[model samples]
Target: MTLRIRSLLEQVPDRLDQERFETWLETSALRIERILSRGHATPAGEWYDQPRDEWVALLQGAARLAIEGQPEELDLAPGDAVLLPAHCRHRVSWTDPDQVSIWLALHFASDGTPQPGP
Candidate 1:
C-alpha cells in the first residue's frame, strides 16, 4: 500500500453557482464527504431526512442550520460540529456569501455499526 496526503481546504473554486459535494471515503458502514457552499440554502419548506445518522463539522467560513421542530437555528463557525440522528430533519439555512464555507460530513448507520447489505 501507499500513502498520500491531501488538504481539505485546497482545490475549491473561487465561485460556485451551486453547492458541491465530494465523497472522500466510503465503506460498507460509513461514508465521509466534503461539502462546499457559498451563500447556499435549502429551498423553503424542504428538509433532509436521512436513513443514516450524520455528523458534520464546519471547517471554514460560517453557516446556519435549521433542524425541524427546533425554535432556533444553529450558527456554526469554523471548528464547530454537530450530529443529526437518523430521520432528524434538517436544512442549511444560511452560508457566508463573500467566502466559501467548507463542511466535513460523516454518514453512518444509526447504531454506529455496519449495516446489512440490501
Candidate 2:
C-alpha cells in the first residue's frame, strides 16, 4: 500500500536528462511519467491517428489542441487536462517554442503493466 501511495506522488523531475518517461511498479498497477513534446506549427493542416483514448495536459507553456475536422480549439495551459476518447483525432494548432514542457502521462493497462511506446 505504501508503495502504491508513493507511486501516485508528484514526480521529482530532472529536466536535463530529457528522458521521455519513467515506469514504476505498484500493487496491481503502474505509474509512469508521460511523454511530451514542444510542438511548433508553421502551416497547420489536418494530421491524424486512430482513436486511442488517453489523457494529456500542458505542464508548461500554452497551446491549442484542435480536434481534426472540428472547428473548435482547446486552449491549454499548465494544470489544464483533457481526457480524449480513444478514437479522437486531434492536432496541435500552436505552441510556445521558447520553453520546456513537463507533462505527466498515465496509462492503466488491464494487465497492470506499463505500455512501452516508441
Candidate 3:
C-alpha cells in the first residue's frame, strides 16, 4: 500500500459554532483524535467521565480545562498537554473565541501505561 501524508493544520473549517471531534485512528484498545473548538465550553454542570485514560495536547490557540476536585482551572496554550486518568471528571471551561483551538488527543485502555516500542 502507498503511504499517505497529511497536514493537521490544513482543511480545518473556517468557523465553528460547536466543538468538533475527528478520529484519525482507532483500535480495540486505543484511539487518536483531533478536536477543534471555538468559543466552546462544556454545558453547565456537565462533566466528562471516561473509561479510558486520555492524553491531550493543544496544537493551536488556547483553552481552559477544569477538573473535578481541582481548585483552579488549567489554562493551556499551544504545545501544552495534560494526561487525564481513567474516570477523571473534567470539562472544557473555555476556548479562544476569535481563533480556532486545535487539539490532539489520544485515548487508551485505562492501564495501558505508555512504553517504548521495540
Candidate 4:
C-alpha cells in the first residue's frame, strides 16, 4: 500500500505527531517501522542499533531526519527514502506538524539478504 499523509496541527510544540515506533524488526528478520505519528525523539547521545542496515522512506508526509554527527537535514516528502549505512546513528528531528507521517523501514545485511543478519 502507498503511504498517505493528512494535515493536522501537532499536539506538542516540539513534535509533529504522537509517534508510535510500532515495530522494531529488532526481533524480526526484515525490517523496522514507525507507524502513524507526528515524529520520534531518540535520545541525544543514544543510537538505534540494528543487526543490519536500514532503508527508511516517507510514504505519506514530510519529515526532518538528522544523522547524529551529520550537519545535513533531511527533508523527506512522500515517496522519498534514505538508506542508512549499517550502524549509522540517526534520529527523526521533525515531521510536518500539520500532518501524520506514514513511514516504511526496511533492514537487511549487506550481503543482499532480505532479512536481518543471522
TM-score of each: 0.92, 0.55, 0.92, 0.65
Candidate 1: tens digits of C-alpha lDDT, residues 42-83: 899999999999989999999999999999999999999998
Model 3 Cα lDDT, one tens digit per residue, 1-118:
9999987788888799779999999999899999999999999999999998999999999999999999999999999999998899999999999999999999988655665533
Q: Kindly report which residue pairs in candidate 1 clash with one another.
A: none
lDDT of each: 0.95, 0.57, 0.93, 0.68
lDDT of 4 by residue, 1-118 (tens): 9977633322213444357655544654576665565645555666676567888878777788778778898888998888887778777777766667787787767775455432
Which structure is stronger by lDDT: 2 or 3? 3
Candidate 3 lDDT score at position 57: 95
Residue 7 in candidate 4, Cα distance off native in Å: 19
- The TM-score between candidate 3 and the true structure equals 0.92
Looking at model 4, residue 11 earns an lDDT score of: 28
Top candidate, metric lDDT: 1
- RMSD list, candidates in order: 5.0, 8.0, 2.7, 7.4
lDDT, candidate 2, 4-74, per-residue tens: 34533245343433324455433334344544445454246665453344566667767777887677888
Task: Estimate candidate 1's alpha-carbon lDDT, on a 0 to 1 scale.
Answer: 0.95
Model 3 spans > 4 angstroms off: 112-118
